[model samples]
Target chain A: MSRADTAGSGERMKVVVTRNLGPDVMPLLQERKELDLVVWPEDRPCEREWFLQNVPGATGVIVMLSDKVNQELYEAAGPTLKIVSTMSVGYEHIDLQGAAQRNIRVGYTPDVLTDAVADISIMLALMAGRNVRETTELVARGDWPNTAWAPYGFVGPQLSANWVHPTRTAGFLGFGRISKATLARLVPFGFTDCVYTSNPSSTPNPAADAETARTYGLRSVRRVGLPELAAQSDVVFVLAPGGAATHHVVDAAFLRGMKSTAVLVNTARGTLVDSDALATALRERWIWGAGVDVVEGEPHVGREHPLVREPRCVVLPHIASATIETRLGMATTAAKNLLGALFGEAMPAEVQM
Target chain B: MSRADTAGSGERMKVVVTRNLGPDVMPLLQERKELDLVVWPEDRPCEREWFLQNVPGATGVIVMLSDKVNQELYEAAGPTLKIVSTMSVGYEHIDLQGAAQRNIRVGYTPDVLTDAVADISIMLALMAGRNVRETTELVARGDWPNTAWAPYGFVGPQLSANWVHPTRTAGFLGFGRISKATLARLVPFGFTDCVYTSNPSSTPNPAADAETARTYGLRSVRRVGLPELAAQSDVVFVLAPGGAATHHVVDAAFLRGMKSTAVLVNTARGTLVDSDALATALRERWIWGAGVDVVEGEPHVGREHPLVREPRCVVLPHIASATIETRLGMATTAAKNLLGALFGEAMPAEVQM
Candidate 1:
């Protein structure tokens, strides 16, 4: 008797993957005989109408940050949409209320991309502070003519061990998972003090926050006001979420308070900072430099962008979670979440209301 | 005028800064009116004739990597060349033997660039392993024409946190300050084991290494043979020095021994690895990917470079110490070293041969 004859045929379930995933991750779903997977072939964002049509008969949908999962999508997905798993940590695009009301489990990959994002954040910070783009452009543009030795040419801020002395400190605007991860990366660079401002939450616990800081080897991690954070920090990181509560948190006043030798890194969200204010600060030498991943308005960012035009500003395409491994892990997790919900199992990483 | 009258003119010494430094750093040196500084006016490598002509009467020379401080150049400066300070951590171009023979103290910037290099190493590793370049190229080249959903299109490796389980270990080719710092960054991501291969001269006492590992919250820090490091490590880093003792340390044999999911990072030097072998390994899937900063023949690197053609290879233009702050610090330190040595004071970071 064949092995196939020994195993009884189970009912197959339809799953729609809304975006491209990793090659290795696809085999995991493809190998399952009881699952039928429909994959989109394009590399860019999927059309809303195409998704609306395809998702109607599907048991599960796997998506990414570009795809918005709202009430319309949920309604189009109908009763068969048991799971909606996004291959990203943040699910702001997903209508949580719709999922909750429909009794459909919501799965979003979190923590998976922490290292990748943290890595990019530090890269952007270093690149922006160091004038990497300017130097690279100098080489690329073949502006080598008249190149001669001069003092104070192409110099960027230094993250010296001396900067972590008792008098110096690192600051954060909006402390979260990525900020903590970034702090862990900066610790070895001799960062001694950390002052951060987090949004006032209903659940207030100072001891837990203190304990978390201690665990991460931070000498001090105090939650302070925005003004205090700006004044004391040698390097200020904007790592808060993008929403009405924290929009333009780092304005002109905060930038002016920073040390002239200080650096600014924003990897969380672009709107968390006032780009025009940052340009003025850099132009006026209020702060040393700025590194930004997400700009106030991205993709639309052109040569005319104020930060791009500024020599001290380092602008990168919003690619914090762009690493292959992290993206793949995110895809796999998303796939597994969809499969779990479809097969009547607990979703691996579900976002509850 | 009264203070100037009190100060003596003989205290002023002739100093030639070989490269451009930060304006802030220069002000610090300028604060010492006792030093007569001759600063370079351009950002390129200094002309050899200009250096020779200027050096005859100077007490010290602050140089960059582009400037070769050889025996001939030293003799031209005569008895006046008391110190030769480089604005870089690596002093290979500087003739250590000649400096030692002349009793000329040398100063180099080290330890300062450790965090920056370590940070870049992690960036390259993530970028390569995760297919950052290829995906970025895809987006930049406008190859992303359609917006359809496809499974397994642009997925890359994600050094999953799961790999840092008790059974898994992260290995290093050379365990030095930067390696230790890199390990510290990886610990929070769940890396447990820390095995490294170092030269016999720098081998740590087994007990001390273990204790250090414990202090850093690592499961263990053990020394092993090259083969063992290759066989047991989940991710092997080529962080050893470049000279004769460790050339092509990571070759086909080492790559063959690594797990298929493992990654290799080389931020130390290009000669430490075999580029051809690495390209072959990546192509054959012997190992996952490689992140490299230094190429065997750098500056001459082009699009046709073997690693550049490989999708899994992430090549950076030797930017380990490219951070603005670190570079500025190095330049400042070099300037300080020159000023201090010329004026008969202690060098801030002198290289003890």
Candidate 2:
């Protein structure tokens, strides 16, 4: 069927947006009169039924990580769908094989989120090490006036390397773009040494590690096994991908191995850490503290959640890439990806299938 | 009185300690058999009466910022007191002139706290810019699941510069050690320009500013007036000294002049910012948000305090130096200074009047 059969002239095409893209980014799609647009009314994730019904005749669609783009959704869109654009770097929710079978291009927002996530990672490290949550809560609860100033009161391990620990070491579970960005930020904090573990399938590159160390002016940067990463690091960052293969990577055993003064930061994915085990670790002082932006089954994490209830854990709802600059960039990239794929122009960032 | 009169047959010198230094630093003072140490029993600031009563015939006193070292105390201690060592960088609470007149060497912990304060300053900047306090509070309150994930949902101005805004600017109220260290951290976040205001007594150093700009790969680092700093800065850091000269420096006019998207961080002194004006500014959206580690009349900031009640402000209980490593260094330095002054080995960090 032609565009005329749907609602307008043959030049007009239907494009469905999974959620509101806000005033800054909506105009990019709305300005194109040739495209008929449908935005889900809710500020929250769109209903699956509404998406399925609306996407049936759509030539393109924009989605978020919360929205799964799988075989059923592809079948619902039929032959009209040419592209699926997601406003996130991670495409785990999308079925790449299914999309490839349908010859549909997948566009995702990346590179733009690096700074925001990196900022959050460093913030977590500081918050965890400084005990920002507990200490701030005390002040908010009207306890500041009564609390006496003591020499060692409210003290926690410092994030920066100092003369006391002249050779402070940093560890990363996955030394990807965000982790590298975090390392760059920490260099000014007086961190001198570094260790990381990448994907098990990938080979270690000593040359690249050495170059990274020299570039950052660090004492050393080397790949390490999980135990060494846990035992030696002053601060450990979990920045690896989330999937079954990496589930519970930072479990009881891993937490047990961490130094009592070390801090753990997870700005990547929740599934990589075991929430219950981490809570226990914090309770037992197996590790000093944790700062996590994501938790297992997030958006459903209540006050009763293990990590949420952990006094030493700084749990934030998933907002690692929640900066105005980043979200706008993601939305614009998503819109541009859809517009480009629809018009036969090359996508600015297409995910390889 | 001679050493024999002060203690047991010249075997020990009388020393008054205002509070118990923790395990990591206690040994530095305790290991000296030549010192007869009298530690204030409570884990709080030693009362003035108790301190006065115990300081008599003491050769040295180790104190915190909360302790007042006035002329009366100096006279009360008589000619025996040789040193007043404070475990803080700030010495406003101490009577420096009185100490000098009494021939009492003043030692303070500086340099050691620079990294900790600088770390907190950046943490506040990021927290304010990203709305971490409000967003995380929502999550902690179990309201996150209901909150929508709109593209602009928890979005705030990014701390880093990007293609859209290639020149991000950072402003400092004081260009001191902490401010420079904070600037170092911001450079990695993509801040390209900096403006700061130093003490009026300080001579303008164009060469140093130029060198700093080049070292950080920044576009410029010029000393600017309050109005220009307020208007041009994307993030204004109130890091000036806390006294009459700098009190209420970030007042209503300054807040009003700031960009609505800008963030204000105060990790130095709370008096530098007008709490009521800042609260009103945040309430009225005159500015984006603020993160304050220090508040005016602190240790007394209750829930009813305007800054504490402001939703956009993230308040901490004056914990910029609340890091284990920094605090330990401070305690050790204070102890060493006392030991040095008492033994006539030249105080390592003597505060010259």
Candidate 3:
């Protein structure tokens, strides 16, 4: 399609926001005089049929991580769709190839949430390592009436001291922007070595990895296989992108390879870890503990989730980027990206072809 | 009492533990067979009469910060007390001069809690800065149904970004072990300058302060007055000791001097801050927010506390040294101190007379 045809065919650019982004982001579109906005009123997921019907006339759509922007949606939306901006740092929900074929300019809020997510990752690690939830629950439930001092009654590893241990090692699965930031935060806690396995790019560079490690004051950063990462690490952080290519990467073999004193932290995606395997690992004490920000089929997660029921597992409701400051900054950044793209200006974080 | 008289006068070496300690600590005395240990059964404050009664026979007493080991208690003990081992790092509760005159050896647990307290200090700071309490409450109460998207809703400051503005600075009320550790953690988050005030010690030297700052990779660390610390700091952290010398140091004047965008974090002692003044500061928005682990008269703290009701103030139960691993290590260390002092062995951490 030519530029003139695409511009003339537009029947008011319709944008659908799958879930309520609150006023912090909504006003950015409402204030725009040129665009027409349609919002999902309910907090629940938008129906597939409703989304498909709504997308036919839309030139751009602002979606959440929960919304799946796939080939069918791209075909249904047809040639009118020019951009798909997700209000998240990760863009795994959108099919990259489909978007590429359709020439859809993808914009995601990255780096804006690096600090917030990194902070939460550390919080979860501490909470899990310290048994904050269990202890707090004990105090809140008034169970202290029968409590007495006992050896090893309630104890979790202290990350700082543990990091300094001679045997301690850290592992990152698919180390990228956020993992690097997380490593930076964990460095002072005495993490001496790091090994990561990410999806191989066309060309591998040793200098890039070395520079990244130096930036975080890491002693060493080496690329390794999954088995080595699991076997050697005291704390193995699952930070890989979520998709079919990396789904359920942390299986029984991987968990079994981890030391009995090891901890696992997953801030990347729920699908990256096999829920059943992780639950078993925690229940059976294959690893000391696990801190999970995302669980398989989240938002539907409730009391019955294996992680939720396990005392050793600290489960958070996908709050890695839920900080108010980060969320607002992200919303504004996404808005700027959308507005910039629409006006033929440079997008702050545009998906490269 | 001379050494000969003291050695022969003991019926049984009576030891009073002012609060509950680990079971392992009690067993050390039980195993000796020559010691009579009087343990506090409840978490409540030990009555003055009860403490006095126990002190009369106490050759050694294990006390917490809540107990005041003053001259009166010493006089009541009648020269029987030979040692005072405090479970905490601070010694403000003990009357140093009174103990010194009687040649009482004082032992305290320090350096052991540096990592634990530092971890909690960062936790509280992040929790307060990110509105963790409110957000968690929102999820717990199932308030997502009524929530709306706002351009800037529920946003807190990110520590990773440039937090220092011309009008914003980071201040420390006491530049000690925990504060130094906290400073090291904040270095990755872009804190360039730090100002602190410390009580004058016998040997006045700024060398320790300079060395600490340099070790943490901070650009500058300088001693300033209380008013200057309050006026210049964007985030004022209270790690100062609590006593008449530094009681309610962060009063109305200090809060008033703080920038509107500033935050206050108190993990040291509740008495260092004026509760009423802090409530007013938060209610009136004198500063952005506050994260308080210690409140005035804790354990007695309920939902009715002024800071608890305030949205901006994040009130946590005193869990600064509450990490599972740290607490366990502390329990074991405290036990070692008791056993070591009794058997005349070298204690891993001992307070000098």
Model no. 3, DockQ: 0.25
TM-score of each: 0.78, 0.96, 0.81
Chain B superposition TM-score per model: 0.91, 0.96, 0.84
Q: For each candidate, what is the lDDT?
A: 0.74, 0.89, 0.74
State the lDDT of candidate 1 residue by residue for B200-222, as single tens digits.
78746899887878877878889
Best by DockQ: 2
How high a TM-score does candidate 2 get?
0.96
DockQ of each: 0.24, 0.77, 0.25
Per-residue lDDT tens digits for candidate 2, residues B122-197, read: 9998899888888878877988667656677788888887656878999999988889999998888888899998
C-alpha RMSD between model 3 and the true structure: 5.2
> TM-score of the A chain in candidate 1?
0.90
lDDT per residue, candidate 3, B1-353, as tens digits?
A: 23323345535678887766665456665676656788877666567788988788577887776689999999988777878887777788899988889987777777777887887777667666666656555544444335443434566666555312322246899988888888887776667788988886635457876776688777678888888898877688899878788889899999999877678999888899998899999889888789887777765665666777777777656666765556555655666676566556667677666
Task: Please report the candidate that would top TM-score against the real structure.
Answer: 2
Pick by lDDT: which candidate is best? 2
